[model samples]
Target: MELKVLYFGMIAEVTGCNEEIILLEPNSNVDQLENLLKDKYQNLQHLSFKVAIDKEISANDTLLNPNNEIALLPPFSGG
Candidate 1:
């Protein structure tokens, strides 16, 4: 399956793009995707970020769908 991944903040800096397409197994989960990304972008392994699917924060084990919107978001703080 091909998934479109959006990158934000420092994550975008690490990826060198705001978004990109990633190919994964049909039944791949967030954890698998994370591993693939970390392998592709070594800097990501040293960063702390959250994976959001379709605008919602997803768990590591969450199943990913073909049409789901995936995003890598860096940590943030607000007053």
Candidate 2:
């Protein structure tokens, strides 16, 4: 399945782009996506971030769909 991945804050800086299309196998989960991303962008392995699926914070084992809105978000502090 083809997924659109969005990079935010420090994650975007590391990726050097705000968003991109990723192709994954059927029934792929968040962990699998993270592995693929870490392989493609070695620098990402050193960063701490959260994965959001369809605007909700998702767990590592969360299943991904082609139509889901996926985002990589760096840690943020609120005032």
Candidate 3:
């Protein structure tokens, strides 16, 4: 399955791009994707971020599909 992934803030800096297309195995979950990304981007392993599925923040390992829009959002800061 192919999905669109958006990177934000520090995550984007680590990834060196704001968004990209990722191909994953069928029935892949958020945890699996996270691990895959961590493997691809070694810098990501030390950073903390939240995974958003289709614009909503997801806390669990949600199943992903080809049409799913995923976002890697870094910690927020308020002035």
Candidate 4:
């Protein structure tokens, strides 16, 4: 299964992009997927963010379906 991930704000800086597509196995959990990405991009460690599966925030154990639109939303600050 493949899902499109979107990076926002500072998250994009670490990843060097606004979005990318990630492919996962049928039984892959969100945590496993995050680990893969962290391993691939060393800079990701310095950032804080949340993952949303199909516009809904998902936990580390959330299972992703094929073509699900996953988003990596970084923290925002405005005052």
Ranking 2 against 4 by lDDT, winner: 2
Model 4's alpha-carbon lDDT is 0.83
- What TM-scores do the predictions have? 0.97, 0.97, 0.92, 0.85
- Ranking by lDDT, best first? 2, 1, 3, 4
- lDDT string, candidate 4, 1-79, tens digits: 7777888888888888998888777888889888888888888877788888888889999887776788888876699
Query: Where is model 2 more than 4 Å wrong at Cα?
Result: none
In the range 1-79, model 3's lDDT, one tens digit per residue, is: 8889999999999999999999899999999999999999999999999999989998657999888889999998799
Clashes of each: 0, 0, 0, 0
What CA root-mean-square deviation does each model show from the true structure? 0.6, 0.7, 1.3, 1.7
lDDT of 4 at 35: 89
lDDT of 2 by residue, 1-79 (tens): 9999999999999999999999999999999999999999999999999999999989999999999999999998899
The segments of candidate 1 whose C-alpha lies over 4 angstroms from its true place after superposition are none
Arrange candidates, best TM-score first: 1, 2, 3, 4
With candidate 1 superimposed using the best TM-score fit, by how many Å does residue 74's alpha carbon deviate from the native? 0.2
Question: Residue 42, candidate 1: how far off, in angstroms?
Answer: 0.3
